[model samples]
Target: MIKKEDDFFSDMYQSINRAFADVIKEFGGFEISKKGFGFNPNFDIKEAEHDYVIKAELSGMDEKDVEISVEENLLKISGEKKEEISDKKGKYHVSERKFGSFERSFTLPPEIDSSKIKASFSKGVLSIHLPKNEKANTKKIEIKTE
Candidate 1:
């Protein structure tokens, strides 16, 4: 019974994921229309004590192909993933990988220091660190009783 339930939930989750992907393909965001490709890399944004870190998973992509920019509070990550299908190889029996260009934009908090942003790519993962401004640093406040 447990196995059946797990399978049912897994199937439902997969269905939802497929549907979401279809929607993304149908309605691309940012530079989706310009690129004519439907590949959006997954990313995670985290907040630390003095910085905001964004990590994006971009398998099969070179660091040179990706570009990062920050304007005001808008952060943009754009890249092109070249198709790896070799002309020398025979027709693919199954091709599931996607190729082309994709861009994702995020609105960062105003407290971040865009000038001090740092970015690094390693092992198909892109990490961006946005240092917090001096005014944004955490500080304890005490209330004085009158």
Candidate 2:
């Protein structure tokens, strides 16, 4: 009787799984997976009196792997996260870490002084300082009688 009950439950489970699979196939087999995809890093942008600052959180990455550049009025930041190799040979039950190349671009304001921009990376964080053009500062003009 115990054997019969186990077989019955196993058959029922298989049947349900088949039914679900058939439904998914009928709906064009929609699947969602994040494996082997580039991950986006969090960024913060701040505007100061004389400059703008951009900070990005890029953990598990080295400074040499990242690149920053500006062209015209656009600022682009790109980097890659490489997967580490293990010396020991073993099967992995579950792997959730993301590793790939990522690129992010921002449209810089005309007031920014692209020639004076500076960037630094430390502790897995990237900081960019965009100085404003001296002439871009607000100035008050007195009206004269014509």
Candidate 3:
């Protein structure tokens, strides 16, 4: 079922939106789904006593499929998830799983010690530990009233 409207502005807006989405698609910015555009995996960051911990959900991906690196103040995590293939081909259903390459980068704070960072991936979860440097560690300063 399709409904056409005589609204010129709305039609122009839709055309612009589609063109923008096409550009994004060309650059692998996101994957268009029924709901909307989806980008990257879900992740969470937590600040601890001496380190900042980042955990990203990367289910169904092996360690060999993932890569992590740090340059300047940016930590990059990139990987590819291969799509599964079934021997018997019969398609007429809903397919929502995302299978492709993805890269995610985070700009770390200046207080982080890049040299002593640690990363571990286990059970579909990628965890990163960024220890704070001595200068960036918590310090107590005395207040002087003049």
Candidate 4:
């Protein structure tokens, strides 16, 4: 049995509202989610006595395509992934991989030496190691009597 036109319209209206809400939340900022398509809003960061380590999972990506950088206390990760398969051509199939440019930024501690940061990508993971500045080490003090 077919439903009434008003009922169908109401359902469509709700769906549209939810889609709009998603865009607003994405643009205005919202809590991070690990599911579905979209950028990873948050990444795991750890701090050691000697360095600040940042690691992110980026599967189906090549090491040559990623770019990592830090400016002052901010760190940014960006990359583009393409959709290509070497063999088998067909239509009407399930595809769940995301392909596009992604960017993520984080504010690091003041003691991190941005110039000394090292980045490496391996086995579908990207790691950034920011070693503490040379000044972070203890300095000698001189006592003077006047």
TM-score against truth, every candidate: 0.71, 0.66, 0.68, 0.61
Worst 10 residues of 4 by lDDT: 33-42
lDDT of 1 by residue, 20-57 (tens): 77787778743223342356788999998999899998
Clashing pairs in 1: none
Check candidate 2 and list the clashing pairs: none
Q: Model 4, range 1-146, lDDT digits (tens) per residue?
A: 43433556546766776777798798996634322133342367887778878888888788887888777688878877766665656553444455666777788778888878888889888888989887776567999999
Decide which is better by TM-score, 1 or 3. 1
- Count of clashing pairs, candidate 4: 0
- Cα lDDT listed for each candidate: 0.82, 0.82, 0.80, 0.71
lDDT-better candidate, 1 vs 4: 1
Better of 3 and 4 by lDDT: 3
Winning candidate number (lDDT): 2
Model 1, position 122: C-alpha lDDT score: 94
Error of 2 at 123 (Å): 0.7
| Reference-based lDDT, residue 85, model 2 | 82
